[model samples]
Target chain A: MTTKIIYLDHAASTPLDPAVKKEMDAIKTYANPSALHQLGLEAKEILNNSRSKIAEILNCKPEEIIFTSGGTESINLAIKGIAQNKGHIITSKIEHPAVLETCKFLEKNGFSVTYLDVDKDGLVNPKDIEKAITKETILISIMYANNEIGTIQPVKEIAKIAKKHNIPFHTDACQAGFLDLNINADLITLNGSKIYGPKGIGILYKKKSIQLEPLMHGGGQEFHLRSGTENLTNIVGFAKALELAQKEDNNKIIKLRDYFIEKVQKEIPRTFINGHKKERLPNNANISFLDVEGESILLYLDHKGILVSTGSACSSEKLEISHVLDAIGIKHDAAHGSIRFSLGKSTTKEELDYVVKELKQIIQSLRMLSPIHLNKEEIRK
Target chain B: MKIIGYKQDKAWLYSNKVKEHFFNPKNIFKSDQELEDYKNNADGIGQVGSPACGDVMEMFIKVKDGKIKECRWRTFGCASAIASTSILSEMVIGKTLAEAKKITPKDIVKALGGLPARKIHCSILGDQALRKAIENYEGKK
Candidate 1:
């Protein structure tokens, strides 16, 4: 028999909302949106309505919204599409792999990139971005909220810096769709899966003044930026999900997130919370339990039906420490023990209490098997 | 052979035997006090790896009449590392030093039904600790 799953990995991906599913299941748009028939015109009208709804929420023109496959494609189009021959780009060290890897690909293609560092709390200094800009700098891409630590960046300040330098700015806001959407960025990326919508659909908002190179050449879709047959069903679900996500009672989720963080720290010894205390997202709680391997603890927790993510190398395919934890200056041993508990709207206090109790037992059992000796005095503090 | 039914198929990372040993390991010290007590009472003690490098194994044994009367271990590592050490302690408990030394990491992996390729390094650790504990026992005589 399968145990009841207490899902705490919302930052990874959230389950689709029932309303979104209902909306998608009701869709009858089967003909291609580009076809010249009455059915195609109906499909195009549905597509435009979804775009207008998203644009209204984001407070931008409807023409600014360009649909892509997902967050990765949107990010790639923003970074690579804006980039031309061998110029400098500015981004933070704590960006998601989509942005980081895209910049790395540009670097290999004879572009110079300045990866600005984050502080211990994983906050990037806007002044650092201003200083990194050069005459050849073409784009500056930063994340709105980090997926691992949930540390939100000062995107407005960074946007002002980019504007002063006459450089185009992009912010991957896939993790921040539940919150405010009025970000002052030239290019913004949002996805469906993170906001309780269907996967495989993403939105890229490009200001009308910016010139972008098309990544795909077929049918001249997505303003000729990303060419593909539109995923009409997913687009409708994405808009509905984004609307419902903003209407959620986020204060309730924040309270549970804080309760989980506080309970884990108080009950489990030698544990400390990662990321900033005040500037973090309402749904994320990253904690490092000293001296225990993250994957071992994860397996133990999984056996108890508590789902979470970890930064430990054993859990990663690369067998490499998390770049986010590494950028925040957490020691290797502490990084190896880190686990992320990202809460969702359905998370309740009793569920969190159960998780804290299970986590305490798991950490105690793992520590008994561990050979590393933690300083008792340091842990007490 | 299920890790979690939801997002990933982590069961593919290990065999059923490995998961069994990992969840409820064999021949492990019950608590910190018991481990401290055994450290003082064990006939030979061997430790391998460091916490900084992310895996460490500590093995303790009690020898009687040139055979291991008891074997117990502790480890700070991943699933394969802990399971390997737990099964290794059980494998060497009643064996003579020579016979125990003949047991290789391959043998441990085979006994556990096989670990992933990247995690094979985790299996090597238990064999190293067992050999070192045997060496420590022989060095005294």
Candidate 2:
């Protein structure tokens, strides 16, 4: 018999909700939204309705939303669109690679970016954002919540700082869609896949007052910002997914996530939780098991029909440590032992209990195999 | 419950042989008692990589006359590193030190069907650990 699979990697990607799928399947307009014919007008109407639905959920004007490929593209557009040929940008080190790499590319293109340091809990100090701002500062880009560690940044505070400086603030809220959506920023990046919607569709919420250089040049679509044939099906599904996500009462998920974190730390010896306990996302639990490698634990868990994600160097192609963990001041050796368990709507308490049981055994077995012995004092750190 | 094989999405991540070794690693210390026993009775011990770097392999061997009679190993790493050391432990058994020393990473990769191109370095680690284990044994003599 096949073992029942337990999925705890929702932060990586969530399964498409059935309602969202139904909405996508109901789409009948095949013509491009940009076409001038009658069918195209119908598709355009559907697109506008979907955009309006999303705007209603986000509390923004329908015209301010620009659909892109996904969160990466949305972020690229938000950062690159606002960037001039040479200017200063401020972002935190714990930001996702999309933001980090885009800043790096800008650095190569004559822009100077200050990668602000985060605290031990992976929090970006708003004062640091203010301190880093200069006369030449163009924009401030920071993630709403980190993908790996799940530490939520102080977006409102940073937005206040950016407002005082008269700078555009961008927040990648891809991982925060399930949580609160009252983010006050000049530009916000969100994607469909993370919210149980179809992939390859994302949204960039730009205020009516802001200006951006278009990343794509085509038929003058997306208010002359992003020009392409609109993905109507994905847009419909995304809107449905966002609507459902906003209505969801996340107390159950938050309880389950807390239970998992508490259970794992209690049952597994020498295990410590990464990121801030109270400030993290309700679905995320990043734990580090000392003296054992993350990829080995992940493989063992996968063998037992439990899917999770790891940030260990062995898990990646280049064998580099996780930048989020590094920014949080976790040692290089300990950084390789982190596992992120991001809960979803379908996750149950029994599933989390099973995961903890299996994880205890796996960590014990891997510890027996390990040559390094970490003491309790070391684990306390 | 037994997961029969690699899932369809991850079937190409590693070869079937590598999966076999990973799921059923040979001569691994499954308990603290076995590890303590090996610590006292093993003829030679070798370790490579470091915990700081995300992989550490501990290899132990027992010799009979001039040939390696037994080998046991463990690793703190990914599936490929564990599988490489697991298969290497089997390869070194029943061979003289010189013969085992000649077993290159290519041979281990060949024996295990093949590893991902990026994981070739993981196989090399086991080879180096084996050579070091032999050296430790010879040095003791």
For candidate 2, write residues A165-190 as lDDT tens digits: 99999999999997777777999999
CAPRI-style grade of the A/B interface in model 2: acceptable
Task: Report, for all candidates in order, the number of backbone clashes.
Answer: 0, 0
Cα DockQ of the candidate 2 complex: 0.45
Instruction: Give the clashing residue pairs of candidate 1, or none.
Output: none
**What are the models' TM-scores?**
0.95, 0.95
Q: What is the C-alpha lDDT of each candidate?
A: 0.87, 0.87
Model 1 lDDT tens row, A57-151:
99999999999999999999899898877799999999999999999999999999999999989999999898898999999999999999999
For each candidate, the DockQ is 0.42, 0.45
Which residue pairs overlap in candidate 2's backbone? none
What's the alpha carbon RMSD for model 1? 3.2
The deviation in Å at residue A157 for candidate 1 is 0.9
